[model samples]
Target: MEHEPLPSESHAEVRIVAATPEVARRVAAVLRRCFASTEQRSYPAGREGGTRLHLTLDTARAAEPARSWLATSESTDQDRTHADEV
Candidate 1:
């Protein structure tokens, strides 16, 4: 499906579907874990279809950068390292 960006960064939408409720739940759980989404609501799909889930991602919450990773190291290392190591 085509995606259009919403007017604000605080809100985002995703549609999830599966052949059965159990599978749908599993997929939704995995998505939530990976993307930190919250389920706004869900409903049964049209004929010959399974469950459909409407989820929202709170980008405002996710936008905060992790400062610990951004802090510069105070010590310089003599050992050489490859760029790919990071």
Candidate 2:
């Protein structure tokens, strides 16, 4: 699956699947440099739109320098569980 950037953050999406919480935290750290918060959302697979395992990075306080970094297409590497009525 291809990750798409958050509407809040000038179209930047980085997709990494099945990442452990540790990995998520680290990614969140990197994203924090660019965005304010990164949220994890999971979509069930094999359905319409296929499914999305993604993090939404919000750029509420993205300064000029951050914007500049975003303009460039640079890359890098990489979770959630809901228990009902435990």
Candidate 3:
């Protein structure tokens, strides 16, 4: 299927473009997370490896923090029960 990723051997290149180092790192992190077992590379290091290091516009989604217990119905019920018992 087109959705399938190419084999490691088939992947012979890496590219990066970003406004700063932080952006580049975030991009690399996301690529690594999404495409398991793929290497990310960097040009400036002049060293080659399975993992690539480069800059790119990040399109990765950030995980939102979990809501506090007080924000949920479970906590509300607990509070009501405690008030009734008092």
Candidate 4:
């Protein structure tokens, strides 16, 4: 089946498939720390009984540490580029 694309580049659909629900939720929790996200919806992944979780993230609305981290990363990349030219 064809899935519809996200409304914009700043929005993303995240899917976490893991061997257990706890693992899936753990991953989702980590993402939630960095981005604004919808509540996760959980489903059974396969006959063997893994978990599949879905959530929507708004990248444009980054959380505290992530915003700082991204800014620092950009600066670091620029510094590296300038250094390489020297």
- lDDT tens readout by residue for model 3, 5-48: 53344232335555555666787776555443244445443243
Model 2, range 16-59, lDDT digits (tens) per residue?
A: 43335455556656766766545666555333334435665554
Q: For model 1, how does the per-residue alpha-carbon lDDT over 1-86 read when each residue is reduced to its tens digit?
A: 56566736655676766777777778767656545577547778768668877788654454224223224335568666658432
**C-alpha TM-score for every candidate:** 0.53, 0.39, 0.33, 0.71
Between prediction 1 and prediction 3, which has the larger TM-score? 1
Per-residue error for 31 in candidate 2, Å, reads 0.6
Give the total clashing residue pairs for model 2: 3
Estimate every model's Cα lDDT from 0 to 1.
Answer: 0.62, 0.54, 0.42, 0.85
Model 2's lDDT to the true fold?
0.54
Listed per model in order, the count of residue pairs whose N, CA or C atoms clash below 3 Å is 0, 3, 8, 0
Residue 40, model 2: Cα distance from true site in angstroms: 2.4
Quality of model 1 by C-alpha lDDT:
0.62
Ranking by lDDT: 4, 1, 2, 3
